[model samples]
Target: MKSFVFRQFEIRQSADVFRVGTDGVLLGSLADIRNARKVLEVGTGTGLISLMLAQRNPKAEFLGLDINQEAVELTRLNFESSPFHSRLKNIHQDFKTFDTQDKFDAIVTNPPYFEASGSEKDKIARQTVELNFRELISKSSELLSEQGVFSLIIPAESGNDFMKMAQENHLFLIRQIHIKGIEGSKNKRLILEFSLTEKALEESEFIIEKSPRQYSDPYLELTKEFHVFKNRS
Candidate 1:
């Protein structure tokens, strides 16, 4: 597995553990963490999202939870090796069974959106075999503070269903970012944020590429602080 090297930290990957990808990076970079002091990451794959959040908000402390033991260990290693080591922590625990009286200022996750697929490694990280959308919404509603926000990156097709479930849990949609793989392409992903308080929804679109293999200006600018792209514009 190829490690994702950032300006301030590195994500060392293992073959069995889920690798750092664009989705995690997008959530880390785009998730609103400015007002959050205590953040909880539901699925800590390689610790990428929390690490990026920690870098973005120096005052924020992060706690990561993962059902997979190997992922938890890998996330711990990545967190310990980063500059924000003191502010980051990870545990091997399933979010479904996680019982915490402490409320998080921000609950973030790149949830398992894929349906159940028979596989041994990394299946739990990608599929909803253990945790589904309804479960995630219910637990997040219970764990988020009054002004706390629940944020996630998921497939475009799943957006409506997720929002519906969240609304049922009294989580209002606050922000939504539609992601297009190409400039003129249909949305491929959505970066969503929900809060307890009802507020005006903020909607926006982000394009990942201008053309094949070319990063869009907005995408490049959004990730400038973290990405160490060669010949970066």
Candidate 2:
């Protein structure tokens, strides 16, 4: 697998772990972490999102968790190699049973949403076999500080259900970004931010591309600090 090179750090990928992708990039770029002093990433595939978040918020410390042993090792390597390594840590543990006394100011994840079993390469990292929406929401609410935010990128179709589940757990929707793969296409993904406190909701839309192969200006600008593109002046 090719390593994803960011301006200040590089994400080393592994075939056994979920590769860095658009969803993780978007979460890392767009997740609300400005006020966060401690952040927890639920499904740290390659530690890409946490690395991006750490780079974005210099004062934030990060802890990543993964159930898969391979992913844990992979994230460890990526975190140790990053410039913000001193503030990053990861563990191999299933989030459901993982206990901690520390509360996080931000909990971010690019979670696997597939409910049906698929014969995919990284099935555990790509399916909800181990962790379901209900468990994730309940656990996040417990782990978050009073003013903490929980953020993630998942299928747009699942947004309503996720928000509802979050609400049941006392996590209210605060921000939502409807994401389209291309102009004129339906919103396929959603970036959601929730908090324990009820506040005014922030909503927006993002288009990844204007055409099939061309990136939109908004997408480019949002990721300009991280992605190293070719043929740029």
- Measured against the true structure, the TM-scores of the candidates, in listed sequence, are 0.97, 0.97
Each prediction's whole-model lDDT (CA): 0.93, 0.92
Report the lDDT tens digits of candidate 2 across residue range 72-131: 998899899888999999999899998899999999988878984757768888788889
Runs in model 2 lying further than 4 Å from the true structure: 118-120
Q: What is the C-alpha lDDT profile of model 1 across 1-233, one tens digit per residue?
A: 77889999999999988888899989999999999999999989899999999999999999999998988999988999999999998998999899888999999999999989777657888889989999999999999999998999999999999999999999999999999999899999999999999999999999999999999999889999999989845
Worst 10 residues of 2 by lDDT: 116-125
Which stretches of candidate 1 lie above 4 Å from their native place?
119-121
Clash numbers, per candidate: 0, 0
